[model samples]
Each structure stands twice: as C-alpha cells, then as structure tokens.
Target: MAHTLAQKILQAHTDEAIMAAGQIVRCRVSLALANDITAPLAIKSFRAMGAKKVFDRDKVALVMDHFTPQKDIDSAQQVKLTREFAREMGVTHYYEGGDCGVEHALLPELGLVGPGDVVVGADSHTCTYGGLGAFATGLGSTDVAGAMALGETWFKVPPTIRATFTGTLPRWVGAKDLILRLIGEIGVDGALYRALEFDGAAIEALSVEGRMTIANMAIEAGGKVGLFAADEKTLAYTAARGRKDAPLSADPGATYERELTFDVSGMDPVVACPHLPENVKPVGEVRGVTLDQVVIGSCTNGRISDMREAAEVLKGRKVAKGVRCIVLPATPGVWKEALKEGLIETFMESGCIVGPATCGPCLGGHMGILADGERAIATTNRNFRGRMGSLESEVYLASPAVAAASAVAGVIAHPGSL
Candidate 1:
C-alpha cells in the first residue's frame, strides 16, 4: 500500500505501519501550541484535568499575539492568566510583548516544527506548518490540553486531494491569489476533512513564505491540511531555520480522493470580496470599489517577502488621503528586518501606519478596527462579515501587493494599475 504525504508523516509519528484515510490513530506530537486567546482556556482545561507538569516543557508554546499590548481589561486578564500558567508549568516557549509574533509564523521561524513532525495548536491556521511537510492541524482548546499533557493526539487520517499548479505566476500575482482562486472554485466546504496536497512545478518553485501563506488558508477551504512535499525548497527553508529534518514525499502510487489543477501563467490578481473568502473576483472586475482602510499584515501575508512586495509598490507613492493604511510585520524579527531593509521607512513615507506584530484588526481585536459601514482591503486571511470591525463594515482580502496598491488608489485595484 502507498501513502500520501500527510499519511507518511502521520505514520512516522504513530506505531501503526499502515493507516487508511478516515481511520483514527494515536500519534505522538512534536509540538503543542496556543496563543493568548486560546491558551487561557487550554490552561484552565489543563488544570481541570489535574495534569501537573506538561509532557515536555520545551514542546509546548504559548504565544500572545492576538490581543497583545493589553487591549482591554478582559484581554489583559486573559494574558495574565496565560502568563502565570506558563511560569507555573515552566514552559520553555512562552512568548509575549516584543518576543511574540503570530503563533503560526513564529513557530516555524524558530525551527520548532519540521518535516514529518505532528503539530497541534488551538488555532485553526496551525495548518501553516503543513507547508513544511508536517502533519499539522488545529485542535479545540480541550483537545490541545490533552496533547500538552500526554505529548500525543488522535487524528482521523484525511484523504488527500492532489492540487497541481503548472505554468509560471504572472507578475504581481502570487500564492495568495492562487489560493483565493482555489477557494472560489471549491467553495468553503469543498475539501472538508481532506488534505490538500499541493504539487507540480509552480508549487515547488514557490518561496517558503508563499507556501506558508497558501497552507495557512487551507482552513478557509475546509481542508484538514494544505500540505506540500518536503522538496528542495522546503528542505532548504528548514535548513536555513536550523531545522535538520530530511525531506519527505508521497509514494508514487499514493491514492488521492480527488485532483485539481491550476495554470497560473495567465491568472490575474484576485481578491475575496466582502463577507466571504469563497466570494473571489479578479481585481479588474472589482476596480473602483471605494475603501476606508487597507491592512497589509497577518499570518497569511506578513512575512518579509510580503513586506518587500508592499514596499516595492508603495515606494515613491502615497496612500490616498482619507484611507488609513496599516502595515504590520508578522514577527519581531520580521519587523526588525523590514526596518533594516528600509521597508518600514518606505511605508511610513507613504503615510501608512506601521504597527507591532499582532493579529490586531484582522480579528476585530483592536488597533485598526473599521467603523460601521466602512470598507477596507486587507492581506489577512478571512473576510467574513464583521471580521475586521462592525457588522456593517466590509473586508476585501488580497495579497500584500494588492492591498498596498489599493491603499494608494483608494479603491480595489491591482498592483499593475499603479
């Protein structure tokens, strides 16, 4: 019997020599992660279960990125609770304040996750690590508690959906556009409980940051994991991060439940329009839609590459008056790198506000929340109603380049339009 990339990783972590799709099995976890929003609940569950010490202090990560800088009394208290718990458990990966970044980006940058590893987090975008060929997925707070205590978790092996991308990406089009196109084609529930195994020349040629962005949005398509084989690009990325995991691949005869192919040679910049990620349209189709704000940062497109893309577009340009453009770097390191590379100066010169590394605004948490009836474009993952602010406000999702261009145009426009 052959196995998909996800199954290969799952099998390595479990005692079972063979496991089929939909079969549940117990597997050892390489890392268990949660953030300020989710950790408070997971910590409470950890105590309720009467587990004194975590399975391994080094294996548990607690990040405070969502509502950090102490948004309000409730959020501050939540972080306080998580902070105290981290100290009590002697957690080695606890991060807050300047040390913390978006959990998904922070973990991989720190080499805490690698190929063939099994990772579970109390955050849905935890599938981001699957970009590195790890069998990663999200878990509820309670389930995260179990993994933290036992160092193992159970999963129903997801059948693989092979999505092959051919042809080179057009200028200004990137992984974000590709993923938006995919979600639009499949709808939200298209790949429910299935692994989306990305492949072909285009996917293999994508940068590590690009791969992570695509995998991070897998949840929006109802995928169990958006995986890619640990090919040269992936292995090189891991090696640069100080992770030494060997590459892994699916068997030649691996079984797939379905297959989808995309040719990116002619695809244009696209966006997920107001209210839903699946409601995508080419940027040209939605040109001239007014906006009140534009955000360029999130776990999805907050990497250094994304920052560079935005800076390249905004250089010698100004954000349209009345539109509040906010740029957020994914991590402290990424923030610092952008500053050193003069990207921060470029954004500030363009009249955009540079914020700390937080999930702010993306989750309607704070910092850049939209006013009622206001419309904004963002590089964040989701665009659901009220996702960024008031129920009446609207969010349009696009890549960082598109977000920056829209900020300058004061409307939904493609980067090429600039």
Candidate 2:
C-alpha cells in the first residue's frame, strides 16, 4: 500500500489504517492558528459552539500579525476581543505586539509545527508548513474554532500532483520565480483542490526557507496543500528550532493523479504581473514598468534569506527618487538577525524604510498603502487588484532580488540590469 507524502502525513494523524484521496477523515490537529483578522471570528465561533476552553491550550496559537499595532479603532477592537478571549482560555501560544510575526512564519520558527503534523490556520497560507513535511492547510474561522474546541478537524483528502523540478536556478531567480513560472503556465486554478508534492534535484537543493516560500504560495495555484518530503535539511532546520520529529517521505510506489516537471536551468527572474498571481512574465519582458512603491517582505519572502538577498542588491545603492521602498522582516527573530548582520543598515542606506515585522502592507492593512493609480513591485505572495491600497493601484509580485532591483531602477527591472 504505497502512499504519497501528503497521504501518509494525513493518515498518520488519523486512526485509519489506510486512507485514500477524497476520503473524509477526522484527524488530530498538531497546531491550530488564527491571526488578528481571523481570530476574532474564530473566537465568536468558539463561543457560539459553547466551548469554554480550548481542547489543548498549548496547541492553539492566536497571532496578531495582520492588522496589529492598532491600525484603527475597529482593528484595535478586534485585537482586544481576541486578546481577551486568549487570556480567558489561557491559550499558551497567544502572540501580539513585539512577539507577533506572520503566523505562517512564526509557527515554524517557534517549533510549534513539525514533520507528520496536521496544522490548520484560519488563513490560507497555513499550507506553508507543508514545507516541513506536515499536513497543513487553511480552514474557515468556524472550522478553526472546531479544531480549537475539539483538538481535531475533518479533511477531504486531496489527490496529489507531483511536480518535479530539475536543474539549477539562475542568479536573481529562486523559489519565487519557480512558483510564479508554474502559476503562469497553469493559470490560477490549475491545481484546484489538489495536493502539490514537490521533488527533484532543484527542489531538494533549495534551502528550507526557499521551500517555505514555495509552499506559502501554493494557494495561489488553488492547491489544497503543497508538500515537500522531510529530508536532512528539513530535520536539521527543525532540530535547530528544538523540534526533533522524524522525517517523512512518500513510498517509492506512491500514487499521484498528475505529474509535472520543470527544468529551471534556463529560467530567469520572473514576476506575477498586475492583478493576478497567474499573470506572470519574465522580468526582462516587463522592464520599465514604472513603480511608486517597492515592498520587500511578507510571509512569502520575508525570511532572513530574503532580507539578505534584498540587501545584497541594495548595498551602496539608493532607491530611485519618488519610489517608496519598504522592507519587512517576517518575524522578530528575523528582524534581529537582519539588524545584527547590518542588513537593516543596508536597506536604510538605500533609502528604504524598515518597518516592524507585520503582514501590514502586504494585505493592504497599513504602513505602506498605495495611492490610487500608483504602482508597486513587491516580494509579497499575491497581487490581486487593490491588494496594497486603492482600487486603481497595481501590484507586481516578484522575488526579493527583483523587488530590490526595481526599487533602485524605479521600474520593474532585473537585478542584472542594475
């Protein structure tokens, strides 16, 4: 009985001896997460369900990363309610203020999620944890509430799509380019309701941080979850964070509904054009698209590696006049590391503003909202219409390198072009 990595992880959390794709199964949750935007609704749902206390206080995490620092009265109220609920429930992982980063990044960094775990969050990027060989996905607030109350949630197993990446990535091109290329080829809904299993030499060669970036954007292609088999790199990363879970991998004869292969050896830095993650083009093709803002951070590309790359590009260079460049480290630890390594100074010297670690401008929350008709090149995950501000504003999604280069060029330009 061969099983895909996703199937194996899901089955491991359930009592079922054998599980198939599409089977309805209730599995224990290793971690349940909700951010400020979603936690309030989940708290209301938790109360509506008459759950006085969470199923496992230690397993539930309430993060105030989205609209934190009190954007407005409404947002402040939302956090207040969530904070009160967290205090009342004695949830062990409540995070806010300086302790909060993006939930997807913070959870893995805190060692709260690991291999063979089933994690659910009220936000879509929860799938980001699959990079650690965990079965993680996004659920609605109510479903998250159920997981909080019962320590479990039901999932309709998604069939697997195995995507193999071969060859080496070009300079200035990495995980962000790979994902943008895939989405452009397959459109936004290509892998709808399917589990994306990534493998092959190139994927294995990528750093764990890069793997998390790829997995973080799985939802852009409508994937139920994106998984990478737990390997030495993954284990070492988790071990460094104090998690020692056993590595998980798919059986050799594992089944997959579809197979896709990508040879990235010849790929160049790419960007998801305005309005959609699927609307992508090579950076060279879209060169000279003027920009008003350039943001180089998000759960997708706000890690220390991302900051280092951006800093490398911005070193001794100034952001183009009239362009507002904002850099956000994904978490507090990432921020501290960047500061210690002088990446923060590089960004500031380049005329870029270094903001606290928050989802802020990525979700149009605040800190760097765009004006109407303005354009931005960002290293964030999505770029739907009005994602960063006014409905007339536009967002181009690219890797941190491209975003940094574009900030200097005042247009969508390649790093090599600079």
Residue 208 error for model 1, in Å? 0.7
TM-score of 1: 0.99
Best by lDDT: 1
Q: On a 0 to 100 scale, what is the lDDT of residue 32 in model 2?
A: 93
Residue by residue across 1-418, what tens digits does model 2's lDDT show? 7999888987888997665788888899998999899999998899999988899989999999998788999999999999999899888999999888988888889999888999999999999998888888999999999999999998888899999999988777899999888889788999999999999999999999999999999899999898999999999999999987887899998889999999999889999998999999988899999999999889899999999999999999999999999999999999999999999999999999999989999989999999999999999988999899999999999999999999999999999989
The collision pairs in model 1 are none
**What's the C-alpha lDDT at position 115 in model 1?**
84
Per-candidate clashes come to: 0, 0
lDDT of each: 0.92, 0.92
Worst 10 residues of 1 by lDDT: 16-25
Per-candidate Cα RMSD to the true structure, in Å, reads 0.8, 0.8
**Candidate 1 Cα deviation (angstroms), residue 141:** 0.5
| Per-residue lDDT of candidate 1, residues 93-137 (tens digit) | 999998899888888888898889899999999999988888889
